[model samples]
Target: MRPLIRPKMIVSAVLAALVLAGCASTPEPPPAPESTSAVEQWAALEATELIDQLEALPLDERPRDVLASVRQDEVVVSAADGSREVSVPIQDGHYLSIAPYLDRTHDCFFHSLTTCTGEMGNEELTVRIVDDRTGEVYVDETARANDNGFIGFWLPRDVAATVTVTGVGGTAEASVQTGAEDLTCLTSLQLT
Candidate 1:
């Protein structure tokens, strides 16, 4: 004779089936990352009013070399004053000249861009500058943009070089020649 099926057994079977079905269902995909706004990106570099001061210097007093990096929202000026950090809006080509010669040792300025956050400014970057003439790695370093989204380097004047910048957002390479006179070579790299 067949045994009678109990109500509790049927309920237990149904619950087990439901649990297995729940486990089998696909999970939702993770949310996409939010893009940063221009204004928010400008704030990350901790930039200040340094450009204005740099621009205000008279031509005679200005340093011969000036390097500025241009980004989507802001310009990073390699020249900084003490702990004062400053940022300026980007221009047709963000250019400036400052005098009184702070640290004349460094003559090259490098800028790298991949992306930026409202909170952190421009993305951190690893840059490598190779001396094209001798195949020497002139500079290999990781750095964050100053308030103005610019990174600075000191290289011998009148040297040919190649710069490679890498970051989480992308990588870029550029070629430049150090100026015979103190000069600002603004190298902008697109991170992609």
Candidate 2:
């Protein structure tokens, strides 16, 4: 019998090859914050920008020697093996990165921007977010999970909303808040 080949692995491999070949296109990056070094400039970029840049690089080019974490007000990038660090402030709204899982998940409060994984990686999903109290729709679009199997969202600050994600396995719903105290890593939305 042929060895088992999961569809997800194939997709992930294709995506990885595209990234390694620099065929995956990202929007023109905005002006970098004034800094002394390239790493410093990258570290000072907004959360989305940093993630985009990191995703665009070839595996060998990424700062694998560093680490990433989210705080209530900022995304922190620091050298994993050293003492260098930078805090990129959250601007405009709250950055909420979610990894909706199907079969497994890990306990996460603040998202590890560099290393969190979800079961539904490399899948397309339809996500919709609506204001729970005012009935205002915030987001309704098709989103693709990144290499890490996570989709990040920027929500209006301090609002309570209902987040519904539709994936291949099924749909999942959860309540979310974009407050100063809310968790940044949302991983409990298991598709049923």
Candidate 3:
């Protein structure tokens, strides 16, 4: 038996739609689902699975009441108002999500899986990431931005590094730390 649609294709379609919707303006934040069961369903999903779904959903289909953020140690899934929540420990490598922008950006302490926006959506940019201590180059290639105008990386846990993103806007550099208490979202870089 074969699946009707490949999972990658579904995700790509969703991302392309988001990028198109955001090209002229930022799409409205996903509204909370009407049923609390939506949150429960998300709670049942494993960390990576949950992250994948969260990254793939369209704004209208997202459960707005839940705020999902990935961190160094675990994924925090909670109600937007903080009335309920859960944490799923990360079992392996660390994943970092970054949104590099030119003129617009938002104040995000943690990257929200349901809502976070950046400029230059659907752009293929040159990205370079290096370990600050080991002098190892983790990534030296071109990565295309998802519809949300962000790129993600999988790295070994417990390290600090510098990140540079170069695109049509220009270039920008920033630092990242993957520690027990470090944030998983990087949106401070700006193209000059």
Name the best candidate (by TM-score).
2
Sort the candidates on TM-score, descending order. Answer: 2, 3, 1
TM-score of candidate 2 versus the correct structure, residues matched by position? 0.74
lDDT of 2 by residue, 1-192 (tens): 899999999999999998877855676899986756544766868777886666434434556667777766887887776578888886678777778888899988888766676777678999999999999998899978877777887788889999999998899999999888898888999888
Quantify all predictions' global Cα lDDT against the true fold: 0.49, 0.80, 0.81
Order of candidate numbers by lDDT, starting with the best: 3, 2, 1
Expressed as tens digits, the lDDT of each residue in 81-188 for candidate 3 is: 888888877788787888888888887767778778678667888989899999999889997876677777777888999999898879999888878777788888
Tens-place lDDT digits, model 1, residues 90-181: 42322311111111222334232212112112447687888899988977888764433455554555577787877766677777676533
Which residue window of length 10 is worst by lDDT in model 2?
A: 53-62
Q: Is candidate 1 or candidate 2 better by lDDT?
A: 2
Off by over 4 Å in 3: 1-36, 81-83
In candidate 2, how many Å is residue 14 off? 69
Clash number by candidate, in order: 18, 0, 1
